[model samples]
Target: MVRRWKRVMAFLIAIIFCINCVMNIGVKGTYAENSNKDSNTEEVHTSAEEKEDTTEIEKETTSKAEKNKSDGDLSVDKNEKTTNKTEDDESKTKAVNNTILDWDTYKSKTTLVTVDDTNKRIYVKTGEALTLLSNCSAENYKDYIISLDSSVTGGAIEIPFTYDGYEFKGLGTKECPFEGNFNIANIKIQSTLFAGLL
Candidate 1:
């Protein structure tokens, strides 16, 4: 009876030891699996953070480039504006310098002659007749006579004819001749002369 009780106790102790060993192995395996999962999660989180940082850096670089481009465009626009103003000023100066006549003088000296009036065509028996001609369609003719304020010397009078709308003017004496085809549209004929009439 004593030997049988000892064997039964020994068997019970061995079964308990095996159960404890299996429980310890299971706990170790579960701890290892949890540790591996934690490491993988940390790696994934680190990669995500790197990507976000790269994205932010790229955005900043793009913004800076855009700002620089806009500044360059503004400079170009300013230069163009300056160039335009300079051109306008030059044009105005040219116009002023090339002004044909003083308006007050032009109004005083200019005269119109109509084609129908025989009196409009000045017939000078003493000096060469200065004839004004035009190819443009006729409108009205006002006599523009700038006769000598005083008689010229040597039995010859130099009569000045200032016509407003003539394309050509003739000035000639029996001794010497002078004629000009002028662009009447551009020139303000301030003064001209007729000499040596029949």
Candidate 2:
């Protein structure tokens, strides 16, 4: 009986030792794969929308519109430069054949330049680290994905367009244009008189 009792205690001690070793070793390697499972722990999951919200940058639009009555109706001062809308209209009518480029920014991102020849309108979208040249209309669309250079990731731009510039698409640094592919959906060759008419 004494011998049997001693054997039982020894078996229990060995089992406890194995359990401790597994717990410690699994934690350093793959805890999830551990043989000792804990069922009481709650799982955490985050949705794609939540992930996107976290990645978004804070932006403040300069527009000074009136606040809601609940927030205290305070009128914002009108922007002086925004009145350049009139000048933009003038640019529409004064379209010269010469291509005008405003791509002198120090940063890079995705850019969408949409040309509507029939309506004589242009749309621009620039996003973070992206640039694209596209020819599109209200109904149909085509992209100008030049060399697939990944560096030219475009932005979601909503700025006003400069008048009378031909579409040109580019990607990567000038020294490394082949980093990716670049494509221009369409090209328009115009003389000084014909460019403004389109």
TM-score, predicted candidate 1 vs. hidden true structure: 0.32
Q: For candidate 2, lDDT tens digit of each residue in 89-165? A: 55764553133233322112224344344553334333211222211111222222222233334432221232223
Model 2 has an lDDT value of 0.35
Worst 10 residues of 2 by lDDT: 189-198
- Give per-residue CA lDDT, model 1, range 1-198, as digits (tens): 999999999999999999999988888888888888888888889889988999999999999999989998998999999999989877775554344334233223324212223433322222222223221111222223323222332444332332232222334433333232211222223344323233
- Give the TM-score of each candidate: 0.32, 0.16
Error of 2 at 160 (Å): 61
Cα RMSDs, all models? 17.6, 26.7
